[model samples]
Target: MTKPRGRGRPKGGTDSRSRILAAAIEEFGERGYEGATIRSIAARAGVDSALVHHYFGTKADLFADAADVPLRPDVVVPIILSGPRDEVGERIVRYVLESFERDDVRRRGVMLLRTAVGGKVGSPLIIGFLTRELLPRVARRLDVPDAELRAELVASQIAGMLMIRYVLGVKPIADAPIDELVARVGPTIQRYLFD
Candidate 1:
């Protein structure tokens, strides 16, 4: 007679990480960000919760990996938070524009944006990462009354600019050089954050 299976997941096969990632995408897609949990993901992957943690430190990191996000908000936020406070707007704008200069980054960014627009499974993951992970850090840094709202407003402007310039292919704004765009938009971002 065959032995009964063990209590926990089968000893983490070589494809365990891949299985976990596949499970993560499914879980995140179905439950969105807030609803999904490490336990659930681990369960779905047929692995121990600790194994999930071992492979990916946090839910945010897992989401980033599953979604193939080019940059993690945790990483980007620090860069934005660095440098002089007064020119934060310019810094943020410049950083985003500069990143797009890389052909690979731009291609991936466009694909992700289009996917987000198409109401794909990863939309909530993207939204959750931005609103929950990214905006919160920015809000905390502002440390002002209505800081969350201010951060959201800043995101709105940037999102609109990106959609128009990159996704919609709107001329003028789209055709405009990065430096000009920063010079024009930076002050507005500054006003939203500080003024």
Candidate 2:
């Protein structure tokens, strides 16, 4: 007769991937992206460091997966670019707000933002990800003389809104309806992208 199979997950009772992701988030949150290491995450997850490499090839990829952002720049940038140039700003703002409206996404975003703002190491990762990946793509699509500058400006505005509304939980702005925010902020973002 064959030996009986173990109960629960294949490796003990824990789901390795999920545990790794949770550990990754916690490590990144506490140590920031720069400081967080696969070994540390693995230790936290109760897995071998090789498991992290097996699951995610690179640190950046791991960070992206751990973040689990609802509105990924790769997805949003193309959508914004597909529309009329003049409407790009408004579309971007609307997309961001709409994405954040989802509880799961918002929670993840808020956690990431909090971690990002918590330390020297985390902030740079967040900024670099935005500047390097998202803004440049949008700017390239805009094809304007000062596309880079415009993108930076737009990022500033969006970041501010995110901080005030979600991070800080400021009363008026946080409490305001999505439509109201879109109407108020959309025009400025449009001007930044177009004008």
Candidate 3:
């Protein structure tokens, strides 16, 4: 006779996590971040809702994994916001450049950005998550009336630069040294943040 399974995820279900992630990607692509739920993902994966939590902890965590994004907004936002106000822009630029220095991170970052910029199946979901997760935190930190707008402008600048330099492999930008890029682009980011 076989033993009955427990109430949560199936015991010894090694493929369960990957199945959930695949389901999550599909659910998020169809429903977007705000709309997708753990229960839905679990259902799609043919597992109990508790199994989703057991494997991924939270919806956001699952989203990050499903999206294959290396950087987490919750982690990155704090780092970018913690430094000196005047040097915030430089810090942001440096952070992006440094993060991309890793081949694995660059591959995932480029894929995520490309999806968002190209308006692919999950573009709005990715962009919305990033903007929603990032912009409010930045807006709360800024004293300006147009804090949200400024934050968006900064995001656009960084996104455009990344696309040109990394995705498109444009000359000068792609070839430029990290420090030089930081020196030149940092002020622009600063201006957007505080000016």
Per-candidate Cα lDDT values, in order, are: 0.78, 0.78, 0.78
How many pairs of residues in model 2 come into backbone collision? 0
Residues 1-195, candidate 1, lDDT per residue (tens digit)? Answer: 985656665666557888787777667655655667899999998899999989898987887787785677777887787778889999889888888778556655654565465554457755886788988998877767889888889888887888788767889999999999999999988889888
103-165 in candidate 3: lDDT tens per residue?
A: 666755665665565545457656677578888888887788899999999989988898888
Residue 157 shift from truth in candidate 3, angstroms? 0.6
Tens-place lDDT digits, model 2, residues 95-161: 8888888766676676588767876645776788877888788878886789999988988899889
**Model 2 steric clash pairs:** none
- Sliding window of 10 residues with minimal summed lDDT for model 1: 113-122
Give candidates' CA RMSD values in order.
10.4, 5.9, 8.6
Name the candidate, 2 or 3, with the larger TM-score value.
2
Candidate 3: worst-modelled 10 consecutive residues by lDDT: 3-12
Which structure among the candidates has the greatest TM-score? 2
Better TM-score candidate (1, 2)? 2
lDDT of 2: 0.78
| Root-mean-square deviation of Cα positions for candidate 3 versus the true structure, in angstroms | 8.6
Clashes of each: 0, 0, 0
